[model samples]
Each structure stands twice: as structure tokens, then as C-alpha cells.
Target: MSEKSGHSEKKTSLFGNEYIQHYDKDGNKCGTSEEKTTLFGQTYTQHYSENGDKCGISEEKTSFLETKHYTQFYDKDGNKTGTSEPKESFLRGKYIQHFNEEHEKIGYSENKKSILGTKFRQHHGAHPRDESKKKIVQTSASNNDSGDGTSASNTSSSGKNFILWHVFAGLFLILTYFFWQQWLNKQAKEAEEKWKNEVKIIASKVPGKWLGHASNTVVTLYLTHLYGDRFSAKVNFRGSDQELQMDFGKGNYSTSLFLTSRLHAPLYFPITIPAYNKNGVVLIFRGKFANNGKRDVFCGQLIFDQNWKILGSFQDSDGSVGYWSVGECDGMPSNISGNWEGKWERGGLWNPLEVNQTRFKLSLKQEGKVFVGKVSYIGSRGSSSLRGEICGDYINFKYRYGDGVVREYVGQAAGDHISGTWSQNNSFGTWTVSRK
Candidate 1:
């Protein structure tokens, strides 16, 4: 017999009042009949193995005239073998017996009328050699011809705690994952705020005039902060006024720039200006910073590409049509305060070869008679500090080389033109330059 949900009937047998006889799946020898549950007169039953694993299942119910016992058997693999109807005997509604399909005696239950007029059930099955079957499911002390049997107490465990352990483990893992995701979100938010603060610090250093020196033209840039990562740019190429940058242009030659590009160290902005080359050229500036902090400089070059070579990086000057360098500059000087570039030639200079022609570029900042700025020569691929002064049409300037050597230039200025002869100690050269 197995535990059931519906009502289980009381069967009176020759022994005393008890449930129906319990047997194994094949009805051969009885396993310990577990106290599967005898509810408030319940009827359905579930069977489990010794290790708390489900093995087989069967149930039984009693009627007025007959007793019906339906038993289902299972194999080791838990597959259903078959169901059997037990051969039951109720002689004169008093004596009863239960038999298997092989007609061997298995167990039995009988009904007895008590003095209180209630029917009492008693069931019995025992073997002398097998003490397990001798364990009784339910019994009473109104002894008959049957030998005394001890009450069957459940000796098996159901492994409910093992299943509960698995349930708790799953819950714990879910909670850990939820908290981990929350932590990641918090870290991302903090990083975003830190980046914004850094940009704000950088923004304060911006919003000023930056000057670009090129072999072909000199460019002046005015930056004004508008909002987060945004600004307005007005690019004046010294000469080209109507021509505007592609991405920075609003109609009628105005601009509102978005700072989403390969950023500069001191000045970060997009530079996609229109360069007129008769075939309508556009110059996409990719400048590399020489320093990683404020007041830095950037240098790059423009290559004349008939079919646009997609602008990518400013790592080197491998392909150069005209080289350029940009830097933070003091506001435009008053007079004779612009860029001048030309070539210089001298006889018997260091490595003499007829007349060694060297290119020179000067960015001048003239104040009264004193002017101070930067100068670069073609042989010296970098710029140096320049300081000079102009008295009327006659001007004189000197630049310091990297090795602390000074080169002075004395020239006569006429409008935007300057013709001079430069001397560096015991070396001298003739030079010609003009304002860009």
C-alpha cells in the first residue's frame, strides 16, 4: 500500500484494525512497508526506494461488497512494467485474503463488527525467515489467532533537505549576479562623470587665438566656447575669406563646431577647410600635437591628392605638398606683424656647394620697435625663439638655434616684402622673405 490523498478504508482482519496488506512491486517478498501516509482516511499512494528515489506506485480502495486493489509495477529504469488486479477474497464478509497473479498468498485484510457497531480493519503478512515483512503498518490489541506484530515506524529518509540545498544555491547565484551588474553600472557612471570634469578643465584652457604657419598660407583661428564639447570656429587663412571649412561651415560663412575628431593636445577641433586648387580642392587637417598639455604645438602637412586619399592620421610628413605647424599665438600684432617666408643662399657656408639655398619662415609679433616670435628654417625641421625690432623701413631680428647659437638677420622692409642678409657669427647668407 502507498500514501494517498483520498480517504483510505479500514479493513478488519483476524489480527486487529489496520490498513491493507503492503507488498513489493512483483508481490514476491515485501520490502519494509513505509508509513507512506495514512491521512484523514486517504486513498492514493506514492512509492519510493531506500535512497529516497521514486521507484513504483500503487493504490487501493474498499467498497461494500468487494475489495479492489490496483497495483502498478516499475523496472529499475523507472519505466512502468504493468498493472495488476489483486485476487481478493472476502468469505462471508468476515475472513479475507490477498493473492498475487501467480496465485501465491501475499497478504489480506478482514472486517470485524465491534460492540460499538463500527467495522474495524486488520491486516497481516509475516514470514519466519524474513523479519522485514513482519513489521506492521497499523495494528490494535484486540488479539485473534494472529501472532503479535510490532508497529511499523518510518525508517527511510526523503532527501527534502538535499533538494532545498539546490534551491538555495540557485537563489544565491542569482543574487550575486544582480549585485555584480549593479556594481558595474555604478562604475560606468563614475567614469562618465570623471571624463566630463576633465573635459571641463581642458575647456577652460581653450577659447583663444591659435595660429597655424604653412608653407603656402598662414591661418589664424579664433575659438569660443559654446557648451559641452561644442564651440564656434572662425578660420581666417590670411587671404581666403569666402572659402570656408566643409564641416564647420554654417551658411554665409559662419561656424558651430562639434568636438568629435582626433583631438589635439592644447586645441581640439575639426578642421575640414575648402582649399582651392582650380579643381575645387578640400583640405582635411589632421594635426598632431607636440605636447600633451596646454600651450602646445601641432605640425602637419597638406598633400595634393587628385583623388582624395582618405584623411586618417598625422603621424609623419611622408607625403607632403606643403608642411604646416600650428601653435597658441598672442593676438595679431599691430604693423609688420605677420608671417614672412623665403629662401636664403650663401657662399662658403658650412657645407659649401656653389650657393647653399636654405628656406626660412618667420612669424613676427611686432610691438613698437621690439618684435618677438618664432622662426624655422628648412634645414632645421623645427622652430626656434625669434626676437627683433624694426626702425622705419629697416628691420633686424635674431633667432636662437637649438644648440644656443644665435643667427641675426638685417633687412630692409617695403610694404609686405623684406630683403635681407643673415649672419651667424663667422657665416653669412643672403635672404628674401614676404608677409603671408
Candidate 2:
């Protein structure tokens, strides 16, 4: 009996000891097997062609003492063409050599096995096959005397078969990975779409905005399809605030939130704000739809950041809620408050400096929603008062040079550096600043 996996086939039979043979598409007998035991009770699988021609043989002996591997290869003429025997020690060192039809040493290789696969160096005259490929074929070859000594014409056949099999296997793995990734993306997209639809369905029943205030926080919930979700909400903690994102799937409901307490002003430019490290706040809300009720309502406990637990209720049709407010939670500060030193460049906006031509220094100070800083030309010492605000993870600042000459800077802040565009009136240029 035989089974097929991709382009390779494995055939099994009694053969006195239940050996198996492996082959490729071109009818090349790639490998054969047989079990044998010596006087010392050492048992291993032997490799040969059906006519008893030793194609290759490998035996792995592992016991309490040590583990050793013995491998040898022979051509169609029953002559020892190659031998890869371990040295005295059970180390990675191997004495590997190859011979031609005349039994003359034609090739020799140094093989070593490490964490990153096996490393081999074959020093040969003309024909050089990869030692790894030889090992792969030898490792799988079994003993089946029904087959011939692999027809010397097919000596190189095993290498070709190995290459083609790997090519097919590599392609198969790549395609499988690509399809798996696409499947994951599709599931994520479907989840996002479902959340949006649920928001809409619930929002339509409400038809208006609902506001709930508790303690020092104010909760404003909007039910509309305009802002993407059927239900959108904003939570203001004392002076810090940010929006919330909801995920409802598998009967479990939760919301991801961000703490914008350090931000003095709310950012509305990107509309959908990108999450920062400081903005990872999870709020798990659990509830179920009452099937027998007159109206749609959600009653659940609001678990805030795995800390504060509060009970809340919301009526979908009237846009009404009870005890729906999130209190203050400690969050990491922003990563953009420090002194930045780098170079600034000008485009068509100015002629004094070439594109990215001048070095500059900026001393930035963040106070709530404001960014106060000073910019000075490094070589020229010419300075200007810089004032801007943290717009999400970016800086929107402006400075005046001479005679009402204004240069506006918009840069994205990343760690110690700020890179963005500068526009003077209508002319545009680029600038970069690294933290001092």
C-alpha cells in the first residue's frame, strides 16, 4: 500500500520486516528501508536498492552512554562511493568522502551540526552535491531488494528529486502561510464590521445623544452612523479625556480605551486617534439582550482596567443610561516631553538655507495641552520663539524669524526624534530634531 503527500509517495510492504520505500514522480526510487540487529542488540534501519546495492545507510544509536550516528553511501556497482562516519568522539566532526567509478577520492566534505541547521563545506574537483541533500536522502532510504541499485543514471536522480521536492514544499508552505494570514485579516475585518453594525442597530433605536455624569467624570454617548459606529462615547475624567472603542463577539463584550489626562486639549484632526502605549485601557462590559422585554436594554457590570467595578444600564431606544461613567485611572505619561537637538531644512519657502541644510536646537516643554519651546540655528545662533501643541503624537508649532516671517512646523514625534514638514506661508520644507 502507498500514500501520497504532495508530490512525494511512500510505499509500504511486509518485505519480511515491514520496510517502506519512498519515490518521486519520475519513478526514481529515492529511498528504501529494512530493520537489522547485530550481536550487541544494536538495532537500526539499513538502506539499499532491491538488488542489495547499498544506496545509503544511516543508524542512530541512542542509549544511556551516548548518541552516535553512522552513515554510508554506495553507487549502483555495489562500491562504497561515500562514507560519513563520526570521529572517535560523538561530536559533530565527520569524516565524509566521495569517490568516482574508479573508487578514487573525488570529493571530501567537512560537516558540522549547530543550532542553525547543519554547516557543510565540500572541497571537490568538478561534481559537488550539497552534503545536506545527501544526508536527507540517506536518512530516508530503506532496504528493499525488489528494486535495482538505483540505476547509476539515477545517482544524481536523488539530488534532483530532493531539490524538486523542497521547491514544491517551499511553495506549499508559502501559499499556506499567505492564505492563513489572509484568513486572519478577513476575520478581523468581519469582527470590525460586525461591531459597527451592532452600534448602528442599537443607535437607531436610541436616535439621540445621551449624557451621564458621575463624580468628576462626564460620559457623553452618541448613537449615530455618521462617526462609523452606531454607538460612540467620550469619557472625561476630571480634566483628562478620550474616546472609547467597543468589541462585541462570542457573547462577550468589551471596550478599549485610552487615558488622555495629560493632554490639555482634545485632538480632532485624525478623527480616529491612533493608540499610544499610554492609551491601552480595557473596559469589559457584560450584558445580554432581554428577549421578552418591551424595549431593548443592556444591563451589565463595567469592569474598568481590572480595578474599579461599576454597574451600568442602558436603554437602546431612548438613549438613556444609569450609572454609566468611568472614573480616573493611572496611565503612563507621554513619550514626547524633552529637549530635542537636530537639524532643520527649508524648501522653496526660504533661500537662506539649502534643503535640510541648517543645524538647529529646540528646547521643548509640555504643559498640559500646550507645547512651549525655543528654536535656535545651531551655527548662526539666530533664534525664534517656538509654540505648539501636542496633536496626538505629533507637534504643531510655529515660529517667526525676521520681519513677520513665519515658519510653521508639523512633525511626528518618535522617541528622541521629531521629523516633519515646515511651511513658510505657502512654501514647504522638511525638518528633523533629535532629543538632547
lDDT of 2 by residue, 83-122 (tens): 3322323552333333343444544333233355422222
Alpha-carbon RMSD, each predicted model: 23.7, 20.5
Alpha carbon lDDT at 242, candidate 1: 17
Give the Cα error of residue 163 in candidate 2, in Å: 15
Per-model lDDT: 0.43, 0.43
lDDT, candidate 1, 57-119, per-residue tens: 333323356554334332324343333232323533433343443435544444444576644
Candidate 2 error regions (>4 Å): 1-338, 343-359, 365-373, 387-396, 402-404, 410-421, 429-432
TM-score of 2: 0.28
